[model samples]
Target chain A: MNDFKIIDDVMPDVPPPVVGAVAEARARVFRPHRPHRLRLRFPVWAGGVVAAAATVAVIGTAVAVPLLGDGAGDRTGDGATATATALVDSPGAEEVLDAVADRLARREEPERANWRVETELIERWPFAGDEFLVENRDREVHWAGPDGPAVVEVSRVGTEPLTAADRAAWEQAGSPRLCGSDSDCENDQVPYGRTRYIPADPGDYHLSSVRLSPQELRELPQDPVELKEEILSRWARALKDIENSDTPPGGDVPSDGDAVWWVGQRLLTEAPTTPQTRAAVLRMLSTLPDVRITDGVRDIEGRAGLALTRDTGGPYAERIVVDRATGDPLAVEGMPTVPVPQLKGLPTGSAAFSKLIRRMGWTDEAPALPEGCTPRTKKDCLR
Target chain B: MITAPDEVSSITAPERFGVVFDTHYEEIRRYIGRRLDLDIAEDLAAETFLIAFRRRDRFDPARGSVRPWLYGIATNLVGRHRRAELRRYRALAKTGPPPDDDGHDQRVVDRVAAGVTVGRLSGALARLPRGERDAVLLAAYGGLTYDEIAEALGVAYGTVASRLSRARARLRDWLGVEL
Candidate 1:
């Protein structure tokens, strides 16, 4: 067998205890995929919107936090503490970051010729507790607070220009695979299908030829508000107009694409009470140019969603998650990143599930504490 | 439920959703046997898949399937259960042969490989840093890429590279070769 394919040959059923454990976990934290099911529950949809909105209100605009160096290697120390000591005692104390970053950048890759942007993150904390999709390999992290604009190395996603075929394909899929980072995507179904398009160094990828999804599409009667969401999701017509519109420049905001979103999100949140207001809202939204609402997701509440804008290096959404019943903005959370796909399959973002998803890849349990580690939210440590 | 195994086959294709453990557990068992002791390899291999099933969604579609990630998970479980893995090697080193399933030595190569590996491999593995050891095992044994290793360890891409580089250098030092 090919070395990479060594583990791929075959497998077996897990032991009963393990199977039982996973079953319990699945019930508690995940929802199995219903290949042919698309239940349109309006109230649940509205609840999802509300949940997202709450996330926005809670997470706020700046997602960055001061982590690292807050803990020591003491048995009671958290990631921050251990990282702090690691930084001080690091072999290349002065040049570790530079060396690590350079080594990371220079590593050989499968010469996949496509647009790629790199990110450089500088912090004095080990970001062990979060679910960030770290795009690169170098994590010469220290446990310290940013003395300045903490450096973060990022590779701007080298995206294949929105081709006619890609656009048509996304439309057929019933979800717009618009421009945005993977973080903006839900369930990684990747309506816009990336990573595949990164163009492998050895020409390992090929277009699927087929554009539409095999899954059933939901034709829920979208009321006027839901109509706005549907429009935003129709990338070529709605979102495209926004991306092509004239956007004002600002310190942190992008110059060309986001102004339309700022206005659109405002309108969606205002919950236009009258027909005249709704008309004006739609017209105003229409003016921004093509609005690709590709990063669609069902937030913790369960409403289907769409991304309205992407910042210079972030997600700028003017999402309208209707009460599946009312199809109005039930709840919304304007965000920098979207909920991951697997987590979205759940019925609701229960406290336990939310905590589990955040610690998806790690094994270390949060330390037992006398008065436990006080974290920003339950996602990190106990309240 | 009444018709046939053909009807059952439609519901569970090895390609779509692999077979049950009892029916398809041997290769993984043999894979673990190649490195670890007889005592824990059996159970550790089982725990690996259980954990893999739970975190299956996070598996990258770009990576094609769950096998690699499962191996990564298994590797981690084995790391945590280091003692048992070492015991397998230590027993082989002491006996000058790997223990056979039949309670009798059958394969001649097992005797030579087990005896030769017992001391050297275990000592070298023990000396490796957790990150580097994982990188090496996943690459040399699990056959994962720098990217997959990064995702599995929750470290950055650069960390995977440097860790691999250092790991290779150390393994060479043990093998008495220069990479």
Candidate 2:
């Protein structure tokens, strides 16, 4: 007996689809994207610039680089950096964004030499088996000053199931101890609970693809149009350099709007950008297509803010929620629009990842490294 | 000459994706419908195309053709409903194939023998490991070649061969017939 034919003979034959179902399904392909809040792990530096590779090496941890800048331009088949002509569908969002940019531009604060940012990052860690969705939450502190080598400290808080369904699946799989043995853990997984220090340079900061010193970042053009041009040129040069390299870029080429948004995020979050420059960055982002604003959203920490979302047209949507009053960014998150098969049981709309900004500003206090890590030794600390 | 944005890039143009949808939608729907019911098939089939359109740029032509790639995505979507698939197998094992009312007496007797074989096959399928079962179903229900199954499952060709070998061996033992 032909086993394959036998298997085929047993299966049911479904009738053709209802006449309109196919048309309706095809219509879904071109329907406007509905922006929803999903909390994906913040790629932070990795998604934006090549310099963030330094940050990855410092922590001895490899972060997943999200599909950056693969948005309307990629879909529309316009070449990269086509921001000027991108359609702005949400005028209300533009108004809110403009108001925030104006407020940020007028605000003046004292300049300081040292900066510190404390963040709590929750990432859906990958696993070999599809039994459970494991979320590894960590607390990261980066402190840098003009006079000293920058210090990066990471302390893993915990790792557990991401959702209720994941917990059930874990328990069903005999609850194999996660991150317990050599076989149970991902190779690149940062050791949990203990704070590990990594060496960093104060000058290794990037505005998208362009590396800028603290002084240069502060002195950057404040006009939104000028800033957009500068960023686009820098991204074009970066793309050219990547093309010259032996290895291919490997993923979707980011559009100019994607580049602008990536730089805007970098400026708001980690870069010591002047308030006026930050304002210009926000204004630059408002001009891009598919950038929508949602009022009255809360971050993972329950702080309220207005959310600015860009549907990257990849698996996840990039989101940055900012304080309505001061325009300071409260959180950066990546939310999954499609179900990732590896993350077995994450619910449809639950946050698969998030980074809540606990603290960020100029500081007088020095970075407290882990026991054996010195400020200048340039050594390994995870023992 | 100014190139229209819609036709500039054939690989990622939204307008071009429609061609792919029209070509493969019914075939993909039937594949999913055979594994699960037609109701879930319609929804999942639509979703599969939407996902395919979103990720069209990531499709590497060297790995395989669009047919297996679409099948890969559809198979992945079906894998999401693993419980439903396993339940379907167990239920099929218990009930066997539904009797056709239009058959004659001799045909009915032949169908009864076929029913026993089908039930045994279903039972054997339900017991196979998930990877092996996926390989088997992609071969049987999907009508995909060993190469296509390998690409669809993102596994090596040898792995597909081994999975099919192990799964068919178990089926042969259960049915006591040449596979």
Candidate 3:
């Protein structure tokens, strides 16, 4: 009847020898070692001597000039100098980002009482075996008024049919079409295609929601370094608050660097940015060593852009493609670099999730209902 | 001036680390060993000390004794092997307690009776949510007090109580035991 006693008794016993072995191994590996000045200095001097000798040899060989001013040696030196400078210079990603920042800063700010941000998010996952299911492709339009209540309109574009293998599996599992009648089959098969307008809670207009109020957007730091610090501190505080509430098992609180990068990405995509804020965000992103530049990236719309990719150091990898000419974000895609066990049969490097920004920015006009949509019966409301 | 016997005393970092290890290593190792296989527990136990050693400066003696902190580190390590822990519980549920080598006696008979309950308990523990299971196991097996369990799991005192209560209620219903 003693449940605790039974629980205790069932635990596998650990003998003393095992404990001794572990302790010994730990002490051997992790025990603090005293600093050895001689051991450290020997390597330093040796490296310095070798580097100096190599430099001397290179210079000596260069001194045997082929021409007067622009000799072979001078050319070699110049090439070497240029290569060295290239290492220290701004990378292509940074350069493109800077150009974009400049373009945004120079653009005239539109005078509007509200902003309408429209986005389409596609989520795909593997189900059964070899069967990829496009779970949801939802198009969302969020409107943020200057001083009034924000609103959101969500419409599902369509659900992609199960892959051949998945369809076979679904049929084998009784071919379930959970509906009231045969007439409901079409709607059940593709359950979402109607737009529903919802008034958003005023409290939802925070940085976490990726929607900043005009006042908040204006208050963002213009300086890149200050902005980076601000984002990190805010994210850290949020993470701390979450941890205080419930510590998820095996979940790591992201490091300050990861938080900064995430903040940068969110700002670029979600937050309402002014010219200064946009410039600061780009500048902040440029300072990140991990943001890689890739040329010749095409969005779903087949528009070419430069891609700024950063591995977020998880199962997921995120890439943001920007228009080469305009620097506006064309598409933001997050692909899994490793197999997601939770998704069953999904393989690595699958574009399981993506977000396409169909339209964004400030506008004076109120959001209008879709064509052929009546107020009472909102049917065929999705364009 | 003389210090009171019950008052906590400050010690040098190295000495403190050594004292903490010597005092708590066995209990910490046992805690991890119960959740995971003994082989992995050995390695994780050693790792817990290494982490504790590195983070010794952050350890505040005024807050609580070193035991709860050490157990917390061990519990965190256990959290990392959640899959393995769940698997162990499932395996235990499928296969009842390991065969007893000792000759049949009154004690052996009592143990055999207990084995049946343990098997059911294992199944119930496996079915319990991870957070609730962790709270239950820490209290039932790790011998952590409610406050200590809360500190170890990094949850509120009420959360620890609630999680344990929910887990025990589930177990009570499943096994039809009055516990």
lDDT of 2 by residue, B66-101 (tens): 777778778766765556777877887888655642
DockQ, each predicted model? 0.04, 0.08, 0.08
The residue-by-residue lDDT of candidate 3 on A1-383, one tens digit each, is: 23355456544444555435534432322221223321211110100000101111111211110000000111110111101111112247546656777887687777587777687766553322223342446676767676533656766565443356655665664554411111112212112444545443343344431234567666888777787767765654654453343212221223344445545665666556766776677666655555566657665446677666655334444566777666666677755555554344444344545567777778887877556443233132333
lDDT of 2: 0.59
DockQ of 1: 0.04
lDDT of 2 by residue, A206-306 (tens): 44455566666767889888887887777677656544543212233545666677778878876667789888877666556666677677775668877
TM-score of chain A of 1: 0.22
Best by TM-score: 2
For candidate 1, write residues B1-179 as lDDT tens digits: 02233222211221111232323245454455455643345544543443333222233333323444455555554554445545554554355333322322232234323332334555666677656766666665555676666554544568878887787678577745333
lDDT of 3 at B61: 40
Candidate 2 vs 3: which has more lDDT:
2
Model 1 TM-score is 0.31
TM-scores of chain A in all candidate models: 0.22, 0.71, 0.60
Which residue pairs collide, candidate 3?
none
Q: lDDT of all the models against the reference?
A: 0.31, 0.59, 0.51
Q: Which stretches of candidate 3 lie over 4 Å from their true place?
A: A1-91, A127-130, A162-191, A209-213, A236-251, A338-350, A368-383, B1-179
Worst 10 residues of 1 chain A by lDDT: A352-361
CAPRI grade of model 1: incorrect
